[model samples]
Target: MTRRRPPRHASADELLTELGRLTQQALERAELQKARVELAEALQRELLPAELPELPGLRAAARYAPARHGLNIGGDWYDGFPLPDGSLAFSIGDVQGHDVEAAAFMGQVRIGLRAVAATAADPGQVLSRANDLLLSMDTRLFATCSFLRFDPATRELSHARAGHVPWVWATPDGRWGLGEDEGGLPLGVLAEESYPVTRRVLPASCAFVLVTDGVIEGPAFPITAGLDEVARVTRAGVHAEPAELAAAVIKVADLTGHADDAAVLVLRHDRPPA
Candidate 1:
């Protein structure tokens, strides 16, 4: 004899009612998630600088954009701190992931870099020590950073980059150049890699624009396209103030399709007061 199939567990109406209940539960859960995300975004915004440092003979501005995912708050930070010798240390960095954990790690990385910079007084050495510190931390997390040491008195600037984007320097003579660094892998990935150091004497009226990759990549435009757009927009306004220039570049990214968090730091040397 043929075996009979088992009876349906629930009638059509019953199934629909169950599904409605499930949907309500999911909606409630989503509401909770949204609240958490709002809280996180507010907290992350607090971490960002209230105001860019006001250094004599310089104009500086910074911007940090949070990812649209809502749950992902990647640590994209810029800071200007002073070293023991009175030189200003400027830096921008991004921790690997976009979440609460990443934010915390970014804070730690910033602190470690500051400590190393104060102790070493060399751009390359500071990054090297930061690399070691990252390697010692959680193995999965990594960070890309660009560190700058600027001496306003002497008009000297030294830099080191770790897998970060190229910094653009626009000159008073209407020429633009990319900052040169030997470059190395992002921190926390390798145990003993070394970062290269480079220096330059920024001209009066010259400005350096440093940015994170989030300013460039998304679904509509590829990374190269975003970068090219940045170059084009930035090259167009080489004489604008640091803040205006940064806003211009970021507006292009926003228009293009920068889904992830983006950060831009502008440092321009100006004439000293009489």
Candidate 2:
């Protein structure tokens, strides 16, 4: 005798129960996603220095603003600390992506650089060690960084860039120029490479400006004239306070789209806050 087959159609109560179960699962997943995003952002902020250092004969200020607030936290970090030899070190960098993983990676690189810099103080060497750290993680991501170490007694500032954005330097005589020089590869691009450190005796009352990509670029926003605008703005306010100078420079950039995060750090020599 052939056995009767089970019913093909589910009862209304069974269907309702399944639907409720699915709805609960979806709600739980959404909440988990939100929590993850918040945690990542908090971690990113911790990586950056809360304020610039207070150094003799030197004034500094920095700001880090997310182009748009939310889960899209770009990998931008800025730091300033005094070395054992009574010198000050400033660094700004951007990791490859504007996602959670990039932000997390940024923290690790930032801390590693700081730990190595305290002993090395050579921007190039510090970055070389930091690069090794990144490669060891095997994250398949890279970062662009600019490091500046200033000597208070000599009034000299040494810098190194690893495929990072160009920094602006304004002389006391109102001349402004980009600090672009021959350098090595960016971090994570290769397992081994060396970066060159460029040094100069900064003129008294001079100012240097460091910025991330967001300040120099945006979504189709006057790309051809960005440098000219930056020069003009920086030249006019070369003598402003570090904080004011950073704000003024950023105010003029085409930050309309809020497409990428922006970071600005200003170093002023013998210039009092205004």
Candidate 3:
């Protein structure tokens, strides 16, 4: 019969040395993580527009906040630009995860939308083409977005959604409501999915609010409640400047202790000079 040797115990010096090595490794890993986060944040900032476009009758503003609990970088994004046909385009979206990959995918989605919007017939077609573009990429990430094209000449706004939170709109007279439009599957979900467009004329001195889900959803806060808070704030600020209203809307995330990244885009049609 073979007898097993007595188990050997690590000496005090060896134990201390091992602990030191582990501590160094942990520090190295932490530094690496920090560097990655910084890189991701820089990338995100580069991708997001520096300012929302301003048109003759339309005033636009947007605000973005990183997650309060997790990594400071995320996939929430918003953009505003003018189409070739003289219409203004605005979009806000959230990619699947809150990591570097998600940020990269967000850039891709934004580029796709901009590329397709040039020739796309409407908001629905724009989202559909963007969806197809994402599926063509060699990636598994998905995204949700709300897109709008506003024609300054006609005061018409066409909106489309892809599994995104509904927008909140308010008129100067204290009327407000949620978008509640029919939406399609998120980008990269189904190859054949098609988003539907909803159109309406803007009333004078009215505002439309678009937000990523993070702005209105959290561990302890329900989206419905958050949305109601946004509506109330918007109703009160319908006559305020787009920038002020956007700032107020984004403040709800902090007030509600929302842990995820948030973004708010406010579009307002100012009343013509009397």
Candidate 4:
């Protein structure tokens, strides 16, 4: 049997040098991650609408908050604008992720919805066309959305949902209820999903609330209870301004310690001047 040579051992100085090099590399990687996170946050801010439009008799306000325990970026988004035919459109959605890619995809979805709504007559058509648009994109992510078209002249509210949570509304008489409307599959799930529209006449001086799941559901909170709590809050603030009501609704997420991003949109209808 051949005798093996004595094992050569590294000197302490050489080991210390290697340790220092590793430590430097770790610090550099941490800095790089921080820079990337900052960029993502900036992109998210740019993707969201800076201000909601205020129509003649309708007032709108929206609020958004990042998760308390993540990269501080997510796919939750809310938008409101006037359509070409003098109707106002509002949308709230959550893309399936909590990263930079999700935020970018959210922007794309919002743009697609706007393009489709420009000519689409009702909420259902807008969501259907937008769903097709999302499927055509080279992405596997999906999203849930609630789209609404309000005709101020008739007080008619047309809504369509795509695997999204129920909306809450409060009438001027202090009565509140959840939407619980029929919905289609989430966007990007199928090639051409048809979202059925639900039409109802909103009472004058009514408050309509739309929110992402993050606002109502948490690890420690059940969704049913959360929905009830939101309804109660809406009832209490039925007479408040749209901005105040939006703030009050978003505050629920902070109290629940939710781990996902939260978004809330409040639309209040006041009878046009008498």
> Scored by CA lDDT, what does every candidate get?
0.80, 0.80, 0.88, 0.88
Task: Please report how far candidate 4 places residue 4 from its true position, in Å.
Answer: 9.0
TM-scores of the models, in the order given: 0.90, 0.82, 0.93, 0.91
Off by over 4 Å in 3: 1-9
lDDT (tens digit, per residue) of candidate 4 on 215-242: 9988898888778878988999999999
Of candidates 4 and 1, the better by TM-score: 4
The better-scoring model by lDDT among 1 and 4 is 4
Pull out the clashing pairs in model 2: none
**Residue 113 in model 1: lDDT:** 89
lDDT of 2 by residue, 132-164 (tens): 888888887899999889887777888888898
lDDT of 1 by residue, 28-120 (tens): 999988877676567567666677665688778887777777666656888878789878888898888877777777778888888888799
Model 1's TM-score against the true structure: 0.90
Lowest summed lDDT across 10 adjacent residues in model 3 is found at 65-74
Which numbered prediction scores highest in TM-score against the true structure?
3
TM-score-superior candidate, 2 or 4: 4
